[model samples]
Structure formats: C-alpha cells, structure tokens
Target chain A: MYKIAVDVMSGEKKAEELIKGALKALAEEKELELTLIGEYDIISQELAKTDFDSNRLKIEKADQIITMDESPVKALRKKKNSTVNVGAKLLRKKEVEAFISPGNTGSVMAAGLLKVGRVKGVLRPPIAIQFPAINGSTLILDNGANTNCSPENLEQFALMGQLYAEKVMKIDNPRIALLNIGEEKTKGNKLTKASYELLNNNPKIKNFIGNVEGRDIFSEKVDIIVTDGFVGNIVLKTTEGAASFFLELIKDSFKTNLLSKLAAFILKPYLKKSLDKIDYRQYGGAPLLGVKGLVVISHGSSDSTAIYNAIKAAKKSIEENMVELIKSEFAKNEELE
Target chain B: MYKIAVDVMSGEKKAEELIKGALKALAEEKELELTLIGEYDIISQELAKTDFDSNRLKIEKADQIITMDESPVKALRKKKNSTVNVGAKLLRKKEVEAFISPGNTGSVMAAGLLKVGRVKGVLRPPIAIQFPAINGSTLILDNGANTNCSPENLEQFALMGQLYAEKVMKIDNPRIALLNIGEEKTKGNKLTKASYELLNNNPKIKNFIGNVEGRDIFSEKVDIIVTDGFVGNIVLKTTEGAASFFLELIKDSFKTNLLSKLAAFILKPYLKKSLDKIDYRQYGGAPLLGVKGLVVISHGSSDSTAIYNAIKAAKKSIEENMVELIKSEFAKNEELE
Candidate 1:
C-alpha cells in the first residue's frame, strides 16, 4: 500500500472541502493510505463528519499555515510545523511515498528544493504539467520552476519530460520538441538555438521532433514540450487567462437573450467536455521533477477537486518510481559521454 | 502633412483589398499622403478602379515581392526594390515619415535594424504592442524581437514602454511593472529579481508599480508591462491561441441547434464588439521601438482593416515623432549616468 502526505492547511478556500474530497478519493481507492498534514483538532472534527476509516486516515499536527502573501523562503525556514514543510519532510524521510500541496507555489518549491535536494546531475529541477491537447495531453516541463537555464539544464529537462511522458502518461517513444520561435534550426535566440543543437545531437532523446513554435503547443504535434521557466510560466499563465476570458465571453454570449440561453442548453454537454479538456485544475498539480523526493504543487486557488487530483498525481508518480527512472536515464547518458 | 510608406504586398489576402482600404483611409483624411509601394502595374490597375485623387497617392514600383518563405536577411539584401525595403529606404531618405508593413515580420525588423539603425545608447531594439485591457490598452514591449536580455536591457524596455504609454496612449504618468512570478523583491528567477531591483530603484520611471504576475497581465493594475522577449512571445502566442480556441468554442456553441443559432443572431452584435475589443489585429501591428525610423508590423494574415489601421498607426507615430522622443529619453539617461 502506498502512503501519500496531503497538505490539508494549504489552498485559498475550503480546507474541510479538501479533506472531504480526500476522503472521497480514499473511499474509491482501497489500497491508498493518506497522511493529512494540518491542525489536529480541526482535521479530527472534519474526519468525524466523514465515513473515512480511522485506521487508514492518519493526522499529523502542523500548527502554522503558509499564507499566499508570505515570502516562500521565509515561510519555509520559519514555519517548521507548516503544512508544506511537514508534508515535504515526510517525503524526505520516506514516511510517505509522495507529498502534495495546494499552497503558495513559492513555499512548495522552496520546501521541495531545500528539503529534498536535487537529483544527481540535474542542473535545474523543473515542474512538469500535462497540457490537454487535440489527441491527448502533452507533458510540458519547467512550467515555471527554473527561470534562467543553461543548455545542459534544458537537455536534462527534455530527458525528464520524456521519461515522465513514457512512464506516467503511458506514451511509447514520446516525440520531444524544443519550444522555439521558428521550426528552423537557425531560429530563436542563442539559448533555443543552442538547445536545438544539443537536443538534436543527444541520442538519448527519442524522436526529437526538432523545434516547435508557440502556435503548435496545443496542436499535439509532439508529446513533450521543453522550455525554460520564464517562457514556461508565461505560456501557462497566458493559457489560463485566455481560457478564462473565452469562458467569460461564451457566458456573456449566452446571457444576451432568451434565445442564447436555449441554445446554450443544446450545446451544453459538448461545450462542457471541451471546457474539461483544457481545465488545468482537472490535471491536479504540477510535479517538481528532478528532485530526490516526490512533491506535487497545485494552484494557489485550487479547490477540492484540484487538491484530490494532486494527491492522486503524487501517488501515481511514486508508484511509477519516476525519480529512479530519471536517475537511471542520466546514468546511461553519463556512461555514453 | 504626414507622408507614410505603405507596403501593399505584405498581407496574405488580396492586394486589391488592401489598396481599396488604403483608398478608403485616404478618402476619410485630407491631411495625410500615402506612398504605395508594390508592383506598379497591379497597383495602377487597382488605383484606376478607385475614385481617390492620384495626387494624394504616389505609386512606387518594386520589381520583386518578398515571399513569406524567403529568408528575411537574404530578401532584404537581394531585393533592394522590394516593398518592405523600398518603404524603409523611403523613411531613411526622409521621403516618408514612417514605414508600415502587413507582410513579413522578420524582413520589417531586419530592414529597420540593418537599414534604419538603433537610437543612440540603445543596446537592443524592441517591438512594442498595445494590448486592449479593460480600462485601456497596455503597451507590452519586447514581444519577440530580442530573446536574450540583461537586467539593464529590461530596464531600457521599461523606460521605453512607459514613454510610449505616456505619449501615445495619453496616459499621464503610466504605471510600470515587471512581469514576474511574484510581487516581492526576492521573488522570481535571477533575471526577474534583478529587473525588479532595477525598476524599483529607477527614479526616471514614473509610478514604478511592483512586480505583476501573468494573472494580472490583463488587469488594470499597471499601464506598462515589461519582460524579456522569450517570456513576451509565449504570452503573446498563448493569448492568440486562447482567443482562437474561445472563438471556436463559441462558434460550436452557436451551431448546436436552431434555438442556439437564433440566440447567436441576437447576441451577434454584442459578441462581435466584445471579440473586436480583444482582437490584436485591430491594433494594427507591433511597433519596432528604439529604431531610427518608425516601423510598424501587422499580422501575417492581416486583412484590409488591419492594414488600414497599421497605416494610421504609422502616421500617428511619425506625427508624434516617437523615434526622436525615444532617442532623447535615452540621451537624458546617459547624461544622468
């Protein structure tokens, strides 16, 4: 049975809702064990409201909660019993196979890096998110973890993203593409051009699809899209903003009159399915890859569904032994070098 | 009277459509003169169809056209009489106040940089596009021109963006914010953190707003948002993609049944206005800031409306003497240093 640590004190709203969601997930999956990291009295009271088995649910007391406004490094350093710190510490000690937090991203990333440390030869640890595309979801790495990166760091990101796609996403021989301004080898800045050369030369990256531009990101032309944190963050946030804006536009369109409302009902099912496809919260949290221990970070405003999905993602990553797989891939490359 | 050079061969659609649009623009305004650069025979034939005074329009012959696929550098070097090159050369010779193209971006930027050259003390030239926000449009600089940047380069971008907003957008004392992961001084990667420090300390920048994340990009928190090209490109493209996706979703929603189609008709006017508000094409093209001459680039798939607005934008920039303003701003900073 795999044990996972969940940061119950994290997220912007409804801590009890998150607990109830976790309980729902536990009921559906019999082999999973959950370690709820939060206030003991509050969690115990919430647990008493649910039908969750007392033996299966373990409560770890953490008096402090990391606020979204607090500095990540300061919060992590000072709040020893904070939910994120406690959860990460459990992962480090192997008390839990994985840790999941829907807290302040800075706090989660800091706790993961400072407590867990980097995997060997991993220059920069990237957070990978699965973006739902036309055919299926593509694994996009370094979504915002490492802002500045070296060519070697990008090379490692490609490998890590590739392995994650293969192991977790269950894609065989995932096509990896370097995100660039143009598809040409000579295109983009020095970094992307240099990365293109490295990714091309490296035999370790299976099906190196060369360079893909920003427009092709959602087209499902490649399985893994590797980019540095700066660009990755922009892309991620822009997508979110755009999605929200479009949803608002559609809602506005329907609310214009009675005819539009009737029309909305007719296409409601298909529209919901399409909306679900791009819903980031449905994918749960992004995984902080290339670290020694497993850690998943959800959005700050994530709800119960998002928190539950984050927990499931953590459990899946641990079960697949992603860290060991990444190590072995690096070891193979080192031997070849 | 402001004379602007218009590249009639740039867009993907019919050249006649662009010519007609130019004619319409010329009909509306009596103070502006346009030098239409394209194949003389085709432009002459199209011009004969319109009632626009030949005295107001000057047709210049270019033997060759720069195809979308041709190397920008190569085309600019080889095709001296090409529309883009001719227009830029006209601006250089003081025959026209500014140059506008709805054709190739690379050729426009390359021609502007290699031919027009940069403003003094400007290490790297940037492209600035005005995105329509809820309150008003915000000028987002370094959209994709220079990929790699130092903290100092970003500082220059901020200064230019702020100046553009103040002068063109007519916003008095525009708020400048660095695009980052968090609002704190210690937040973001090395580049962002460094940029934040520079922006925070720079006294020249009026209303130096703190770091704004991607979520706040569309908000009215700041009038000018500055970042490196790499991040800027991702945000720009993601916004474009999301807009396209959202439009498609609306289209699908409207076609679900007869009831929805009737509703779509009722909301058509309101929906069109909303979509038009966020439409980047309506903004014409991004301006190549810090260049010696005013250069505006429209979208590759730009239609007559976009081309017409591009010409108007070029005329406005010239009237305002934007290039001279930027040069003086940089000179003032140098004197201070």
Candidate 2:
C-alpha cells in the first residue's frame, strides 16, 4: 500500500471537510494508507459519520490549527503541530510516501523546502498546474508563488516539467513548449527569449517545440508547457477567472425568462458536460514539482471530489516513482555538465 | 462629417472584403467620410460592387502592401506607399480624423509612432481592447505588443487608460485596477509591486480600485484595467484561445451523435446568444491609445461585422477629440510632477 499523509486542518473547513474527503479517498483506494493529521476529536467525529475501514486510516493528534490566512513562513516556524508542517515532517521522515494539502500553498511549499528538504540540486521547485486541453490537459509549470524567476530557473522548470510528464503523466515523449507572446523564437520577454535558447540547447529536454502563444496552452498538441513563475501565475489565474466568469454568466443568462429557463433546463446536462470538461474539481490539485517527496497542493476551496482526485494523483506519482526519476535526471545531467 | 482612413489593402482579403466592411460602415453612419487607401483600381472595383455614395467616399492610391508576416520596423521604412503607412500619414497631415487598419498591428504602431508621432509626454501607448463584462464591457489596456515593460510604463497605462475611459468609454471616473496574480498589494513580481505603489500614490487617477486578479477583469465592478503589455497580451490571447477552443469543442460535441445533434438543434439559438456575449466583433478593434491621432487595429481574421464595428469605433474616438483629451491629461499630470 502506498502511504500518503493528509493535512486535515488546512483549507476553509478545517478538519470536517478535509477528513470527509480523506475518508472518501481511503474508501475508494484499498491500496492506500492515509494518516489524517489534525485534532483527533474533530477528525474522528467527522470520520464517525462515514462507514470507512479504520485499518487504512490513522489520525495523528494535534493541539493547534493553522488558519488559511496566516503568514506562511512564520506560521510554519511557530505552529509545530500545524497540518502543513506536520505532514511535511511525516514525508521527511519517510513515514509517508506523499504529502497532500488543501491549505495555504506557500506554507506547504515552505514546509516542504525547510522540513522535507529539496532533491539535492533542485534549485527551485515549480507547481505544475493542470489545465484542461482538447483531449487530455496541459501541464503548466511555475504556476502559483515564485513571483520572480530567472532564465536558469525556467530551464530547470522545463527539465522538471518534462520528466514529470514523461514519468507521471505517462506520455511517450511529451512535447515541451515554451510559453511566449508569439510562436517565433524571438517573440517573448527577456526571460522567455533566454530560456528558449537554454531549452533548445539542453540535450536532456527532448521534443522542445520552440515557443507557443497563450492560445496554444489548451491546444492538446503540446504536453508540458513551461514559463516563468510570474507569467505562468497570471495565465493560470486569468484562465481560471475566465472559466468561472463564463460559467456564472451562462448560469445568469439561463435565468432571464421562462423560455430561456426552459431552454436552460433542456441544455443543463449538456452545458454541464461542456463546462465539466474544463472543471478544476475533476483535475484535482497542482503538484509542486521538484520537491524531494510527492507534494500535491489543492485549491483552498477544494471539495471532496478535488481531495479524492488529489489523493489519486499522489498514488499515481508514488507508483511511477516520480521523485527518483527527477533525482536521476538531474544527477545524470550534472555529470554531463 | 468625421473623416476616417480605411486601410483597404490590409488583412487577409485585401480590398474586396475590406471595402465590403467599409461600405457597411458608410451605410450605418451618415456623418462619416471614408478614404479607401490602396491601389485606385482595386478600391474602385470593390466600391463598384456596392452602391456606395461616391460623394462621401474618396480613393487614395497606394502602390505597396505590407503583408502580416513582414518584419514590422523594416516594413515601415521600406513600404512608404503601404496602406498602413499612408493611412497614418493622412491622419498626421490632418486630412483624416482617424486611421483604421485590420492588418499587421506592429506595422500600424510603427507608423503611428514613427510617422504620426505620440501625444506630448505620453510615455507608453497602450492598446485598449474591450472585453464583455457582466453589465456592459471592460476596457483592458496594453493588450498587444510592447513585450517588456517597467512599473513606470504600467503607471502610464493606468493614467492613460483612466482618462480614455472617462472621456471616450463615457464612464465618469472609471475604476482603474492593476492586474496581478493575487489581489493583495504585495502579491505580484517587482514590476507589479512597484506599479501598485505608483498607482496608489498618483493623485490624478481617481477611483483607483487597487490590485485585481485575472478573474476580476471581467467583473462589472471594474471600468478600466491596466497591466504591463506582456502580461496583458498573454491574458488577452489566453482568453481568446479559451473562447475559440470552447466554441469549437461545443460545436464538435453537438455533432457527436444523433441524440446530441438533436439536443444541439434544440439549444442552438441560446448557445449562440450566450457565446455572442463574449464576442469581440461587437466591440470592434482595439484603439492604440496615447497616440497623437486616433488609430484602431482590428484582428486579421475580422469579418465585415468586425470591420464595421472598428470603423464605428474610429468615428466615436474622433468625435470625442480623444487626442486633445489625452494631451491635456498628460499636460496636467506633468505640472503635478
């Protein structure tokens, strides 16, 4: 069984919603062993509501709660029993194969970096955000946090992203595309321009598809899309905002009048299917790539469905031995250099 | 009558389709005189196909054409008789109140800056692209070109975007917001962090709504949204790409099977109505704001509807005396500085 630690005190609902999701994950995957790190009473009470097997579940007692809005690094230092820090420690100690959180993202990353440590020379870790494509989805790196990034950081992002796609996403030779304003090699800002050259020259990164524009992110033709953390975050947020705004607009439009309401009623399932194709809940959370252990961070507002899928992602990442693959990839490249 | 120069030999179809759009514009607005700039024969031939009033129209002959793929600066220097350059000259010469091009964006900006010149002390000219919002629409600035920018550029963007929104978009004291990854003041990279401070400190900018995330761009609460050109362009292209991809996917989904086809047929009009809310054609082309003379650049794939709307926009900009307003706004700010 693959062991994964769940931070049950993170996100909006604290232990209640998170434990409910973890129980669902535990019930769904028999080959999964999960330790819910939070207040034992709150977690066990929430678990009492579900008819899940206790054999696959364990609740680690904790006295304090780290709210979502607390300062990340400070909270990590101060709150020893906080789910984010505790879970990171569990992963660091090899008590768990993976660490999953629906909490303050920066805190998790800080905990992962400070407690769990990096994979030796992993310069900067990137969050590989999954955006729905026409067929499957595109893995965009350096998505959340890491506001400023250099060309070398982007080069590492490409390397880490490509290996993750190859090993975890299980694609045969993923097509790595650099995000830019235009497809031409000379089309981006100073960072993208320099990174493009680095990406092309790196023999380890196969199928470097030069540069791709914003619209090409969901084109399904590309697999791993790489960009600086700043641009990547903007693109990620803008895409999310557009999707939500449109969904709300469509929902509002359907409520205008009786005929429109009837039409909306008929089109509900199909429209939902269409919207669900781009749904974040289905895709689960973003994987913080380049960490020593598997760390998947979900949106703070993630529900049971999101939590369930994140766990599934963790199981898959462990099964694929993604961390070992990344370590070897970097170690081999270091030798070549 | 407001005079506007139309680059007839620009974009995909050259004169034929462009003249068709111009003729439609002429038909819609009677207080407009249009100069079709291209080879005389081509313009007259396209005009002859329509029953346009010869008295309100004039054909200015130009020998060369700048295809979309040509290098922007080089094309501006070599092709003197090109429609983009000639049309810009007409505006510079005060022969036309405005210039509209549905061709290469860089070429138009090149001609506008090098030929027609920028407004006095106008630091960076931003392209204001309209996006549909919950209520009306939002004007987003620095949407195309200008790959690298500083906080000062973004500050200029907010000032210019606010003034343009006030005088032209006609929303009194438009709400100006800075685009960032997170809404917090300290949430962006160095550029945005500095820009946020500059925006808050600028006294000329009224209704400064602080930092807004990517998703908030479409919210009706915002009037004018500002960002560095690079991030703005990525957001713009990503939004466009998402719209196109979703539309295509919906179309493909509707045609999947007989049941879906029937459902699609039943919900066809409603779907189009919902999708049409986000359509770019209704709003017309983006105005290259902060230039001396009004210049509007449309998408290359713009049909007659888009062309018609762009011409309409040009007429509106001239009527608003947009250049004079921008000149005074800058003059006022210079005194404050």
Number of the top-ranking candidate, with lDDT as the measure: 2
DockQ of 2: 0.58
Candidate 1 is scored at a TM of 0.94
Q: Over the stretch A2-96, how does candidate 1's per-residue lDDT look in tens digits?
A: 79888878788767978876887788778799999899998999888758777788999998998988888988988998998898889899898
Which 10-residue window in model 2 chain B sums to the lowest lDDT? B249-258
Error of 2 at B103 (Å): 0.4
lDDT digits (tens) for residues B1-337 of candidate 1 = 8788788876787778888768877887788899888988889998887588677889877767788888999999998888988888897888988888877788989999988888888888888988766556778888888888899999999888887777777789899988887677777777888888888898888788888877667767888998888778767776776666656655775677776577566667766766677877678788989988888888888777887888777777777778889999999878987
Model 2 lDDT tens row, B84-193: 98999899999998888887888988888888888887877888888888777888889865777888888888887886777677888789998887777888888889
**Alpha carbon lDDT of residue A169, candidate 1?**
80
TM-score for candidate 2: 0.96
lDDT by residue (A1-337, candidate 2, tens digit) is: 9999887777775567667777888888889999988878888788887788888888877666667678789998898888888888889889998998888988887887788877866788899888899888999998965778888888888888887788778888999988888777888788888999999998878899888889998887799888877888888878877777777766665666676677556666666677677888888688887778988888888877788888988899899998998898788767877
Q: Give me the runs in candidate 1 sitting further than 4 Å from their true place.
A: A253-270, A334-337, B255-262, B333-337
Cα TM-score per model: 0.94, 0.96
Per-prediction fnat: 0.42, 0.54
